[model samples]
Target chain A: MTGAACVLGVDSGGSGLRAALGSPEGAPCAGPVRSAEPVRTGPRGIDAGHFMDLLLPLARDLLAASGGGRIAAVAVGAAGMATLGEGLRAELPGALGRELGAERVALAADAVTAYAGALGERPGAVVAAGTGLIAVGTDLAAWRRADGWGHLLGDCGSGAWIGRAGLEAAMRAHDGRRGGSPALRDRAEKVFGPAAGLPGQLYPRADRPAVLASFAPEVAACAAGDAVAGGILRDAARHVAEAAAAVCPRDAASEVALTGGLIKLGEPLLGPLRDDLAELLPHARQVPAAGDPLDGALRIAGGLAADRLLLPRDARMLSVHRSEGPSTSA
Target chain B: MTGAACVLGVDSGGSGLRAALGSPEGAPCAGPVRSAEPVRTGPRGIDAGHFMDLLLPLARDLLAASGGGRIAAVAVGAAGMATLGEGLRAELPGALGRELGAERVALAADAVTAYAGALGERPGAVVAAGTGLIAVGTDLAAWRRADGWGHLLGDCGSGAWIGRAGLEAAMRAHDGRRGGSPALRDRAEKVFGPAAGLPGQLYPRADRPAVLASFAPEVAACAAGDAVAGGILRDAARHVAEAAAAVCPRDAASEVALTGGLIKLGEPLLGPLRDDLAELLPHARQVPAAGDPLDGALRIAGGLAADRLLLPRDARMLSVHRSEGPSTSA
Candidate 1:
């Protein structure tokens, strides 16, 4: 006989996609498969066809390796899903049902999954910072978000924001202007070549945010000795905390967590970030993230399979679709 | 005598190309012929072939329209000439000599031309604030520039910068975050459709800087009653003045001038800009621009033709190339 039914969870982000298989009890089963290439987004938002193409083979491999079981439910957490998820919401459910025999599917914004993974249906806020930064909160009632405006208009305290600022300081140093950092200039020239050619190097690329974010680590590396670089991180920290405070629940009992690749910048970013968060959101209890976005996706999948989901649903942030029949069993 | 040996002057910018014919005495002789499309730039930097294709026909048309003057000299001022001008510097002199029978050619950064138009080789700074912001100064020795790093990195206090700040405020209002402007939000939604669709509309376009700059006037328009919008402009003025201060010569008699399309925003921008300029550049005299960039190009061409060009030569900022042999006369 085939193994017990399993749930599939996938987290798609700027770095790539991560998928895991889990039991209804939230225990990991087969594989947390990863693909380093992010799913492409197009005119229709998240390209459902491209997503399925990347996903189905991996799902099949996970299922086969785990002794072949029916997919009871599936959950996908994706970047840009809040604004650009029309394609995924409309097509993912039917496609999942047809291909994986999933009777329940949850489509969620990556922030929502980040929240689920970090706090697990609790009433609080979670700041997800990577190439971009966003804060999502739930009093277990409705979702609130701030920032995540991409590299152009906002994402103020994000990796891209820090990298762009660092590069700007480098350019200023090159031009012999005030507020420049020679240390950051050296780092930037080492990384991106001469400061004069930076605009030509950066502006044309379609993946400009990622390209900009790639330099964030360099900024962090220079922060210890360079006042300008350190100032950039402090300002970045303030913005990040402000974003979190914007979306964090005001209740004293609420918890806040910080997650994502930016935390890897470590103490230079985190030190000011902690101070800012304390000053900005005094009522909330700061906490460590319990898990990652893929784990959150898995948790949501397991919750959907078990009919125990407690997170609030929103049309864009988190939407659930059900197959119009009784639950399938292995 | 073919119209007393007139010179050719061309201004290539974000808006388009504008060409004029002038006598060696710096008086206009023929049409300021316009081409609505800006010359295309490529990986090799400021496509020389495309520039020639656009300019040759226009030069011929201007010559025919003005009774066929001998092109004694040609000067072309282009937007990215300070950096992305290798292609132009390499091929323009030879081509202009062969096609228009021009013996002298001056290729200048648009800011250099703007300075020539505004202050005319004097010891002062000129802040050229248009779609992008750049301040160029000269003590009649060498050019000093601040900002002009393009829309992505710097260009602080630029049209694009102001418009981006306005849009960010609009997005903040949409997200119900602090520092949001509902007035700006209403304006943005009207101009760009729903708040949610902005990233989709903007980030893909190659002309993002121009698109962002298109809203700067709206920001200026709302500054009268809206504090957030007003704040944005005030900050813009500060940045503009800061750029000017960064490049301005620290001499008691040095002059400063403001030039470019952004001047049309009127007193709302100018009021604060005046305050900041007066405070930051107290040593320099403030002056109105005598003419636009096309006039500056014409002046440079005239100067080149008469062998009286006084501006310092820089390989990237203001390069001049002369043909071998004696000067060709009409």
Candidate 2:
């Protein structure tokens, strides 16, 4: 281990935060360290202080493990960066420079990272569907986004949305109402106890979106044999495709990719999603995501380190900051 | 004022708590004191100690206002009493006997109180649609309930539900997606600022349901001219009516009633609600509520004071408790 230049990449989202060390050539060196607790947000916006608290320790560990190499650049892709990112955009760069002595930084919305990870800097759209969903695309100039409105308002085809729809069907079944799904009800009971007590269990929790999303797998599991569950998946797929179509580049040769943990729902979701994407976005070629958001963050960091970043910069979607002070090599 | 035998009635719900003093004849005699904070609930169930803290002070004021009359009985109608009332039920009786000197007590679910308030002891269903929605009924035997699953899972057609739907439409419009409602978007922006910031504004709040429900009136206000808003209300009405039909007794002359603050949305909601109820439950008659939950609580307390309560008692829905020792007149 020598005083080699390495870049820091971080992915912060609903599930948690992950950090990695990468070289300017886009190769990982060591440490994809993780923290299960997500960065907190509040009245001002995404809590920059909380994010720094989480990242500083992770960066120190990664640097130590990499034999005290100097960090040339840092890129952070955070979940709420597009909307609730004022605090992060304003404070993160200065804080990183002061603390880590990293002069070059790229702050990006998680969706943009997913896009970069999926299609590099090419003109394409990427659907990042996890607990929440967002579709992002660029024509090598400007970015377009759809959905990712969180669980209550939008995120229409996201994991939370599917879970909520499934839970509603389960509740309907419990109440013996129309559109009830007995299979979903059974699954719901197995996971969340009796239907009657669900409100008491769910409403008071702060992590409700993720809690609701925890049931998405159950819905996907029941999709194979249950028409109602299958219907839910089909609708979810349609919504995902619609979001993708809303932001995908218009060119026939442009690419569309799916990324995030939700892709693990596998064929039950993918089968319908494929058909919907074909119908809604026939011109765009659907492709598998080359990597996850972490990989995307690393790639962006690498690009910044080499001063050859090709992706278009947007104030909210993706912004680069360079400190005026001389770099302090570790 | 003489030392008359007055009953203590308390209504505890999402909005707050209210306590009134009434004579055994079911006539109000003194005060209806209020506390704006709702009683807290936790893993142990509805916080009995907190309820006591709020109730004791209000009870003292009511008793003092009534010229120190003896409380013959006490009735408390609380939201979530059907499911989250274990702590309240177990501890309230003993606490009330010691604190209020009332030997007899009736603990009722808010829906049961709403039913009692609406149609007395008649075999009918009552839809309690406010921030949340629940339909409860009795056939002079057992209690039946449908849909009160709260904001996350069910609570279909509730104030929160309508508001959430309206906000979703607003987001769709903001995103330039199909099914976008520009009218709703305008209304939402007026109430909640930019559409993109709504999730950040909503998701972190413990009072999210109330906050979301605050937007419901805007949806109602727009229903007359906006088709999307009209559609949301129509769907809300259908959901409310379906919930009512699910619980209404099968008797040809059984009554159905709508109760709760949601009824204030007026013709935009009620017009569709009336038609849907008429279509869904032609056998049952729709009736205006005779009183609110507070009045129902007073009525139940009065009935208990006279030992002629007519409504069938259920362990979860409604339960009666009598202290073993002699009653203490205040």
TM-score of B-chain for each predicted structure, in order: 0.95, 0.94
- Candidate 2 segments exceeding 4 Å error: A1-9, A14-74, A83-104, A302-308, A323-330, B1-7, B21-72, B91-103, B305-307, B324-330
TM-score of 2: 0.88
Collision pairs in model 2 = none
TM-scores for every candidate against the unseen true structure:
0.94, 0.88
Q: What local lDDT score does residue B79 receive in model 1, on the 0 to 100 scale? A: 91
Worst 10 residues of 2 chain B by lDDT: B321-330
lDDT of 1: 0.88
lDDT of 2 by residue, B1-330 (tens): 248788988899877999999999666787788999999988987999999999998998888877797788899999879878999999999889888778789999999888888888788899999999999988878888999888888899999999999999999888877677999999998888887777768876878889989999999999999999999999999999989988888988689999998999999999999999999999998899998888888888888989998888999999999964234433
Q: What interface Cα RMSD is found for model 2?
A: 1.0
Complex DockQ per candidate: 0.63, 0.62
